[model samples]
Target: MSAARIFAVMVKEFTQLTRDRLTYALILVMPIVQLLLFGYAINNDPHHLPTAVLIQDDSAFARSTLGAIAHTDYFDIVETARTPAELTQAMARGRVQFTITIPGDFTRRVVRGDRAQILVEADASDPSATGAAVAALAGLPQEALKRDLLGAVAPARAAAPPFEVVVHRRYNPEAIAAYNIVPGLLGVILSMTLVMMTALGVTREYERGTMESLLATPVKPIEVMIGKLAPYVLVGLIQTVVILALARVLFDVPMAGGWGVLSVGTMLFIVGSLALGFLLSTVARTQLQAMQMSVFYILPSILLSGFMFPFRGMPDWAQWIGTIIPVTHFLRVVRGALLKGLGFADLWQSLGALSLFVVVVVSLAMARYRTTLD
Candidate 1:
């Protein structure tokens, strides 16, 4: 090819690309998103995990051990109570990431050179998130007693304290990856299919050159938008039932919560995802761009919504970004229901966030849809 002809083609291509401002901006923005995700947000070795303590003994050894746990960056004690039920409720609501229980006989056992157990319960829904923090527990009591028991009678000052840590991984007790992944799969699968399917709606109509004829008919923009959305919403719900059944039968992932709660949450999530797709469809001028935009939105949800990583593991800013994603809240609903046996009251904030997402996205789509063929 001649140099002059190559230069002319380059100019024409750049001109076309520049005219598509959304694509142009996204192209620039994705690299920055990547930079933030890699450099600042994505830490494989997570620390300072939220922890709750159940200290039934209120003994000196227990106090010393709790202080030691606080010193380590592995856990941050945010709540303390005397009952297991209280802490379990906190875990069910996702208010706390871990629970440490000091048994009433801890001091007596340690003094007598008996193996005293410190019960540490972890929310192991995402195993990777808890793996590091749990691993850090191996040498805790020994290290704590070495410092705490300088003048104590006998066994308390022994080289290794008679105390041992007993770890209980809650939810996914076996640490089975499938049990965790399957529940999150509900969110991931729904997000991928539902968003992409509806994202193609208006772009499909535009590409087929049927927009003019459709606008010529006596249909309001709101009605036309609803018509485009209704069928996909049904498809989403149908997929939800199929997936939930398969997860139960094939994977044996437990549905610990009520059927009614799961049904309501699935409906809210599907509608929100559909609204998101409709919003994307309104913004994108072509089907390819619609797919691109949806993918842009989808990638961060998968990475930051506590699917691939622990929700508590992510940095504060990344977690803040995740809160805006409907998939993030929806995953909490699914996981809490399926694994923790949580009910509506424990899960209302997440459901409310999803409803708010639908309202905002639907409102934007309504504003963006034009009655004219253009």
Candidate 2:
């Protein structure tokens, strides 16, 4: 109603906003971070995807065909497998996205026009990452042997394709998006709820004038931290069960691996998330700041953690940053356990990473709590 009063209130509010350094930084920094992540880091049509090759044939045609495949800029041959078992292990462990197997008599069969086959196996769990690479293969059979089919094999080149590209889409053979997304939701949901909830719960004590009473108590910092986080851990696990249940019943996502591995990984991630929340509470002066800090963490986790985009699709720097986030490792564990039928050996690195995150974050939260006391 009063123009002068309205102007005064607006000035006061702007001053208050600038004084809240965390919120001010969030406002200024979040947009820049989002722009960089989306512009530079995110790539749906990923190139140089890791590939493994098993060349049973040592002939010129085999070599020529592989040379053509490599030049596509889609598949990067990172490993050479001696046997089928090794190739299987590579895919199982998420080492390679595509595998090429040139049969023992590929050259002989191609020269004789006997419909020689080159086996191409792809990890189709995350279809978006593999789609372009797989599509690149369709043209390879027609174009790969064009040069080698000269002279005696000239007739071979003209007879349809010199070789067949037999593609086997591993894991989610149907390339169902739900297979990738549903399992990832467990990590995302747990990270969102557990971190925000734990941060708010502790910050609420300070807001409600209970923190002074808590400080007056005889309980130690570690004891208080554990007490605050324990309830949220249970809540996270319950959310995990509910999400997994809906994933199976609604989406029909496969639970391929053992429950034991999923259980251990889930617990580690939930605990780590709660520890991170506690750490944020130590840094944030109010519930709003705690919530903002949580968003700062959650946004990158959703983007760079391969929840929404392909992890391998991101640039090396983004991937490196992603590895430091617990959600990235948790997503791997969940997807491996649920979709790939991955065992402890296949998932050890991710599990170990999650374990390390829990230890480091909990230790940092404890240290931050000590600082809060001071």
Best by lDDT: 2
Top-scoring candidate (TM-score):
2
Model 2 CA deviation exceeding 4 Å by range: 371-373
Give the C-alpha miss distance for residue 76 in model 1, angstroms: 0.5
TM for every model, in the order presented, reads 0.93, 0.97
Each prediction's whole-model lDDT (CA):
0.85, 0.90
lDDT of 1 by residue, 1-374 (tens): 69999999999999999998878888998889877774677777789999999998888788888888888899999998668899888787888889999999988888776788889999988788889888888878768776555555554565465688999999899888877888898898899998999999898888898987888999998898788889988898888889889999999998887566777888988888988898899888899899998888888888888887777778898889889888899898898888888889888998889889888998999999888865
Error of 2 at 52 (Å): 0.5
Per-residue C-alpha lDDT of model 2 across residues 212-315, encoded as one tens digit per residue: 88888787888998888888878887899899999999999999965788899999999999999998988788999999999989989999999999999989
The superposed Cα distance between candidate 2 and the true structure at residue 340, in angstroms, equals 1.1
